[model samples]
Every structure is written in structure tokens, then in C-alpha cells.
Target: MTKSDFPALRMTIDGGRLVPAGPFDAERLNSYRRGTVVYVRFTEEKDRVLVRKWFAIIDIVLKQCQTPWKNRDQAHEAIKLALGIVNLSKTVGGDYMQYPKSITALEDPELQEALEQMTELLSRMTGVDVATLKKETAHIVEYEDHGPTTGEIIEHESGAASPDADEPPSSSSAGAAESPSSAAPTNTDTTETPVADLVSVETSGDGDAPTPSPGARDPETQRLIDFAKDVLPLAANTETTGSLLSAIEKEWAPEIKKMSADGQEKAKAISRSMRAIFNRQASLNGALDFFSDALGCSVEELGG
Candidate 1:
């Protein structure tokens, strides 16, 4: 749902969540999402790494799929199709494909056409042509089939849970608890760059603020502050990225409200990534605002 559908705007948050007014339709949101709204508290430093990894994951996969139909490489093409099937699994239903081997379905003419269309749409939305992503991904070849289970991908990576799963959680339960996906997804690898380091609050003109005492310091909290300062400006300019994410957020409630249970679960995966990306930007913007004001400077000063 859009901001107007909720009682608060995207920026309006209370206790780290969107506080919708009264009598909202929780059915519109998937359950694994914890409650209704996405909870985005960066409780650990690794959470920031998870966000960057997710960003890299989406960006790298899209770039691999970008060439014209004839020029696409087989392995990269396979990876792209795998992602597409997984995407379908998220939006359409879990039953569409069971095993990760479902990537082989890309060979079917119908599936090929569908994936081509989806890849193109995602390409347009993410701008993942070679030039858009200049860096090389050396580990992609080695990182094959190393993600969560399909269910976990749907529940954890996808951001929202099923209707049944969400009912058990109180956060989406209208102020009883907090959304689970709000926390960053944990990573298997620790060396993945801590994006928080890149988003330094000190660079945001908070260099002069008094340092927290040793006893009060929480490294994760400080890292998150840095992450926000670094990401907000970039977030401002990513309209395509924003559009793609916005589409994902609205996928369940407005777009697939009439879909079947399986269909809805499948579709909610799309919302998962969308919410994850939005959380990164929203949290960063929130953090930058806090740091900027505290240091008596404009948010723009917080940069790489």
C-alpha cells in the first residue's frame, strides 16, 4: 500500500515502524513480515552488511541478465533465469517450482519469454547494464546455490511472512510487538563489506560531536548512524530503484489482493526485497537527519 493508505507517510515512524491509524486490513500484508509494516532497527553491525549484500545480490544478478536475447551468456543467463523463477516463486506461488533446480525451466519457450520480459522490466527499473555496475563480482561463480531455502527466501529474504505466520507475531498485531524483517538479514560470510563503514556520520559533518563514552558505546548503533549518512543522498537520486521497490510494496495489497493463497505467498517475495531496500534508504535517511541536526549542518554534508 502507498503512504496515503497508511496513517503515516513513508517518513512517519513511531517506535521504529509505520503506525497506521485504525482498523487496517492486515490481510493485505504477508505474515513473515512480522506484523504489517517493516521494522528496520539495525540492531547489529552485521545487519548493515546484509543490506549491502542484498543490494549487491539484486544488482549483480540484473547486470548478468542485461544483454540482448542473443548475446546473453549461458551461465549468466541461467543465473538470471534462476532469479526470475525465484521471483515468480515469490509472486506467483511456492508451488510453481519446488527445487532450486527449477532454474532449468528457463529452457521452455514460454518460460524463456516470460523471463525475458521480466529481466527487461527489472533492467529498466534497476539500470543494471554493464556501465551501471562497473565492478566485477569474482565470488558469483563460487557462490552458486548458496542462499536460503525457498521457504526462508520467501519468509526471510522476501521480507513478509504468510498471513498465518504473521498472526503469531504481535508487532504487525497493531502495536503489540515489532516486525521481524525490520532487522537486516544475516550473512553467511563475514568479510562482505560492512556498508555502515561507507556511510560514516563523521563525513556528514558530525565529526565534531562528542564521542560516546566507552560504557555507552554500541558499535552497531554507531555504524548504523554512519550508514544512514552515506545512503540518503544516493537514495534521493534513485527514482528507478524507488519505482521498482514501490511496485514491490504494492504487489500484495493492491496488485495481488485477489490472488490465491499460494499465489499470494509467491507474490509476497517480491515485496520482501522491496521492503528490504526501502528499509535501508528510510533508515539511513532517518539516521542522517538525526546526525545532521545534532551537528548543526545540512544532511548533504554526510557523504563518502
Candidate 2:
């Protein structure tokens, strides 16, 4: 069947089941067998509107800037690059090159983040504060249509969403997870493990012990600790160091959600520091050591 031949449905994840959220063609849904696979993308209507409106606003403002863009698609690609929202591919010569990553593929949390970064970029380029920028763009953005009311709960097929968001929609694409099946629900609480309880300092036994969870700490400190927990486990011996750095890079998206405007700038700085060691061997250990020096802790204390 052609792409347009498929029907779409709106649904949400409730108690690990896909519950219809709006009027759906029941006949189409019944055509598939129980084990038939489909694609799922989890994005919200509001997020889609925000992204398009921001892009339109940027396109308008760019006419007066040093680098003017007449083409909206090209402008969008440039914006993605300037904001570091890209994927890296190695060239035939073994050097890294950047290509624009799809903004639509971003999950709810990630989409909001890209909009924020786009706002900041537009602000700097236009020499305006966020409040004023919004005011100026409000009219232009309003000219665009807000996508489907009672629309399908869908995702970009790239990343996972937090537990609080809606479930993904089904598509006919193979190799993708079927909607609502094989999708595991995530926990909503962290209180089960006492913050003071000690987790292993390293995945390998050679490292130190009794690293306490930063429970009840201020949100900022706890945020970094949580990030370290997620990223540090990939570090083992020399063989596994690449996994560690890749983990750290992957954490960049969700990790910055809690950061303030100032904190975000500082994060970019720290990211640059991390990227400096990407070419070096033992980069994971170097990164952990760097974090320890910056945070005033030993390497052993770096993990969860």
C-alpha cells in the first residue's frame, strides 16, 4: 500500500494499554492482525505549532540580519546547525561532518528544548529579549494553522518520551516498534531507593564503593548527579571508554532541560570541553576526571 493508504488514529497510553483519544476509523484498526507491526511517533500538537511558528518568526527576522535566508527550509537547516541540533557522520577521509537532524523526530521534552534554543538564537540575532521577540512574532506565528484538534498522539520514531506524555501512533513502517505493544511503562517515583543508599562506584569492581544517591539535595546538584548516574555506568576499562563518551553525548538532550538560561550557556562551555577529548584515547576517564576536578570530587565519587 502507498503511504497515504494507511489510516491514522489518536490514542494515549493508559495503564499500559492504547486507549483511543478521539474519533478513529474502527474498521481500519481491525484490518491489522494482532502481531502486525507499525511505527509510533510521540509528539504533541502544541509542540508542532511552536516549532513552525518559531521557524517562521526566524525566517522573517533573518531578512534584516547579516545572513538573510529567502528559503524557509534552508533557514531551518541553518538554525539546526547553529543550535547544535545535528547528527555527525564520518567522512570517507575519517573526519567528522555534520548533517541537519530532523526536529520533528524529537520527543516532547526534546522539541521544547529545540524551541528554547531557537528562541535564544533568534534573540541574539535580532538583538531583542525573549519577551519582545515573542511579541513581535506572535502575529506572524498566528497566521499559521494549529494542526489537528483531537489529533493523534504520535512520536517522531527517534527517541522515547517521559512517562507523563501521550503514547505513540501506529504506522506501517517495518523494523519500528509496534504502537502500544513491546512498549514498557516507566516508573514515576524514585523514593524506593533511599538517596543515602550506596550504589556501586563502578560497573567494574576495581573502582571505589558506597557512592550515595544525592537524595534531598537541591534540584541543581541532584540534576547533575542524576546525569552522572546515567552516563557513568558505560565507563569500564579501556575497551568500553567509547561507550562512556557516547553515553555522555546522548545525555546532552534531556540533561539540559532543568538548566536555567545562564546554566545552559555554562553547559555549552562544558560540552565544548568534552568534545575536545573526543579525539583522544581514554577520553572517558579524562572526562570523568575533568568532572571530578570541576565538582571537587574524586573519580570514584563520580558515579551514582
Candidate 3:
């Protein structure tokens, strides 16, 4: 529908976010119909002129992965990179919040599978070949010396480790193996390696994530990194967002403009949250002339 269909959510400028005001009831929970749009409003710094925009948490999360992941590893590379920046934003207590726990939790099969699904979906969504990162994962060497695949486990006993991954005729372990149909309990530990240990997005053989060319990335990219790290939390510095938008318009406008309506929206949604930060921060200066098509963040909010 239109903006009139959604309820209003007021977010105050605390420091670096647009936190909803109140005890976080139904209006703030976002558990209602997805169609229920929530428009955020901010009174101008000095003018008190009303500025409003839709604030969607799910949309923002989806936007971050739109950059066209190179693969699961590459996506996590970005995740690791982004996580480092987020951790840099410390509280007065001087402790880094363990954020985006995906880094540490990748070992969980469910998370790994979900991430893989996301990588594939996001790749197709952005039309960027991020799945190529699987090649880096393929290059890893695995050892089967720990235990046999869970399928080969014996009843009421842990799966035995194999000496070689390929040549596997352990004379002593012959009768211990059980058929898949066997109605016996099997061990938890098995040959299937943890995905996190098998493939690290944080490194490409050098044990470090990829780095942006200090001078090569556009000002928007640089500024976004700083903003995620909270270096510019108090101020979104919309000037930077405006510059990036101008650059995108100049370089990608014609091509992006020609894209399908859905494609155009996806492209525009790219890095919308970061733009919101700059826009919200710029509010401190009073009236703002610039706005991004990405996501909403016309004011900074800090939590207690």
C-alpha cells in the first residue's frame, strides 16, 4: 500500500542508532504483518521540522549481504571484516561485544547450511558470483584419521578413526562397522569435519582477511567501515553518503536505471543502513538536503 497503511515509530537520536521510544511493545517488536510499514520520524536538530522514513530491521540485514558475496568463505570474510568494525565500538566499560556470533558459531551444521543457502540466494539476488569462494574451500586438505563417517559407526560404540582417507581396509575394524539400517545408537563425534575449521573466510592462506586498497575504495566504502566501527557514531556525516550517491548516480545510474524495477530496488538497497547512519548523524546539523534510497536512519540512537 502506501505510508498511510503503516503505524508510526518514533526513534530518538541517542548516539549511533535509531532506537524506538518506549518499553518495546507491539509497535516496536515488528512481529506483525510484513506489510505493516513503520515510518520513523525525527524532529530537526534546530528547526524541529518533521523528518520521517520507514525503519525495517529485516530489510537492513538483507541489504548488507547484497554486495555479491564471492562464496560462503568470502561472505564470512566480509562478515569477519564487518564484525571487527562493530566490535571496535566499545562502551564506557571498555569491552567489545561479541557480535555477529556467526564467526564463532559456524561450526554448527544448521548455521553452516543456512549460510550456504543465504550465499546462494544472495548471489542470485545480486547477480554477483560470490559462490566462487567455494574454490578456496575446496583447496583445503582434510584428514580422516579421527573417525569414520558417522554412517560407518558401530552399534553402541564411537566411530573409529581411519588411517587414510582413501585407502581404508583396517583389518581390526572390519566387524565393528554397522549397517545404516541397524537399530543401534551411534556416537556423536564422526569424520565429518566442522565447516568453520575446514574453511576460514578470515584468511586466504595468509591468515588474514582481504584488505581494501587504502586509496582505491570510494569515500563511501571507507566511511561506511568507519561508521560500522562507531568511529562516527554520533554523526552520520551524510556528506559522505551524499558523495557516494553522487558517484553511484554518475557511474551506475544509466546501467542501474535500465534494470528491472525489482533489480533497481535491490541495487539501491545496497548499503542502505550505512547511508542511514550518515543521514541520521547529519541531522545534528539541523536541516538535511540529502537522502539515500537505501534504508532509513535519519537519527542516531544509543541504548542504555
Candidate 4:
């Protein structure tokens, strides 16, 4: 029988028995045999937006579930990512406040199955054992405030340590003290160094006297590291190399173009830099290297 021919399924909500509110459009009904519910068609604009948002949420959740580090922390991170996508899709879909309520109201088995699939996808993406994901979901439902904030959890997973504001400095701080004359110069001065000079410096000393990594170098490395840090948050939320590349392309397009004789070279340089950064070739150092190679200039020159 066709969707219109099939009788509308009845469901209860808020202690009231509610029948399917809208006309059953066959084309819109996606039926899942496992759950005898039929997903409704998007007749209203709000419903349409909800569908779009839900789709995006599902996509992100699925991707995260498939990630290799499946755990409560990872699940928490995935939820945060899904929530962010939900927020953005809400804006794109045009009904931000109504989403939660509408999602709660959906009774179609097909829709339920979709959500289930999303959860499963999340489990897979995160590399969390299925049993573990289920247990964590239940725990999250029970706990009120244990859930970590998106920023906190994501930063942790990304290898950034949270600053403990309440804790006092450790005794080691006493030994680490340096006189003003010995103190390092401001970041601005360091970031302006030429790429050639940056490459010339050894990133490390002998094993006994280890030195700071590339990120600890002068201002140019520091600046790029800062830029990479900002991009991590954005990347976790949406597609593309976080959003830095997009911003740079838009904001610096004119300046970048003016630098090259025909602008094509500048465009190529920007593209190369983006690929290197997003691919995680070698962290911020690699990004700088890519830029230097593209521009045929030293890192010091770029900084200057």
C-alpha cells in the first residue's frame, strides 16, 4: 500500500494521544522495517530545516564514531561536535529554538532508526567499543554536570592541557626563574624572522640538554602555532581545515595577489600552505615550510 493509503500511526506525547498531524506524503515517508515507524515528509519549512540539521548532526556524529580513539572522552567530544553542527544547521535551517522539541516529538520508526544508526556510526568513528558507547550514553543521561564542555574536552583530546587557575605555581618555578636581561623577547620580534634563518636553527640539542620544539622558537613559529591553535577549535566544529584557511583566503586575497606579479603564484602558495596544514604533515613548522617553499622566500623573509 502507498503512504497515503496506509493509515497514520498513532503515538502518545505529553500524556496526550496524538495522531499523525499532517497528510502522509508517500514520497517523504522513509520506512525502516526494523522499527515499524515511517519518517515523515518535510512539508513545513521548520520540518525541512530540522531534517537538514539532523542530517548534518548525523554526519558529524557518524564520522566521530568512526574515529580510532573511542572512549567516554571521545564520545563527549563527538557530542560537542554534533551540537556545534546542530547550532550551525539551525541557523542555516532557520528554526534554532524549535529543534530540540521537534526532535523529541518525532515518532517515526525510520527516524528512530536513523538516530540509532547515527549513534552506531559515532561508536565506530570514535573507535569506542559498542558496549562502551552504550554504557557511556547511559552514564551521560544520568549525570547532570559531569559532561565536559566542548572546548575543554576537545582541547584535551587535541593534546592541549587545561590551565589550572586555582593551583599555585609548583616549586620548580623557583628554579626556572630568569633575570629580565635573560628573558626572551616578545613574540612579535620572533615571528618576523626569515624562513631561511628559521630553518638554519637546530630544533634540538643533545639528549641530555634537550631544547624547546619548533613551536617554542621565535615569534614567527609562535605566531603560526597560535594560528594553528585557533584553527583546531574551528576544524573540530566544521569541515575544511578548521576555518583559518577560508578566513585567510578572503581577508588576505588582495594583499597576497599584490605580492605576486600575476596573483596565480600567490594563489598556488596559499593552496599549498592549506594542503600541508590540513594534512598534518609536520605541524605549524610544516605549514611555514610550505609557505616558504611556495613563495621562494625564507621563513625569516615571510615573517619580516
Q: What does each candidate score in C-alpha RMSD?
A: 24.6, 19.3, 21.4, 20.7
TM-score, per-candidate, Cα-based: 0.17, 0.38, 0.22, 0.19
lDDT of 2 by residue, 1-304 (tens): 8534554554666799776554354445565688988887775444454554455455444432322344555566666654456676788999665566788777668777677666654553333455654544443222221125433443322245434222222111212222221233433443322211222122235422223344633465455544544444444332556656766667676768667774465355335434433432224454554344333344676562
Give the lDDT of residue 92 in candidate 3. Answer: 82
Q: What total of clashing residue pairs does each candidate reach?
A: 18, 5, 9, 26
Question: Distance (Å) between predicted and true CA of 242, model 4?
Answer: 2.6
Model 1: lDDT to the true structure? 0.33
Alpha-carbon error at 81 in model 2, in Å?
1.8
Worst 10 residues of 1 by lDDT: 137-146
Q: Distance from true position, residue 100, model 3, in Å?
A: 6.5
Q: lDDT ranking from best to worst?
A: 2, 4, 1, 3
RMSD of 3: 21.4
Q: What is the lDDT of candidate 4?
A: 0.34
Runs off by more than 4 Å, candidate 1? 1-109, 125-252, 255-304
Question: How far out, in Å, is residue 38 in model 3?
Answer: 48
lDDT, candidate 3, at 283: 25
Task: Tell me the deviation in Å of residue 116 in model 4.
Answer: 48
In candidate 1, what are the lDDT values of residues 21-104, reduced to their tens digit?
222223223223564555443321112222222233333432222222222233233333323233322225433322223333
Model 4 / residue 244 / CA error / Å:
3.8
Q: Of 2 and 4, which scores higher on lDDT?
A: 2
lDDT of 4 by residue, 1-304 (tens): 5645443333223455344323332222335355675464322211322233333333333232222223333333333232221122245666332111234345556454445444443332232333433332221111111112211111111122225211211122132111121133534553332221223223234412122355455443333333433343333232665456678556645644444232333344334434433543223343344333322334454442
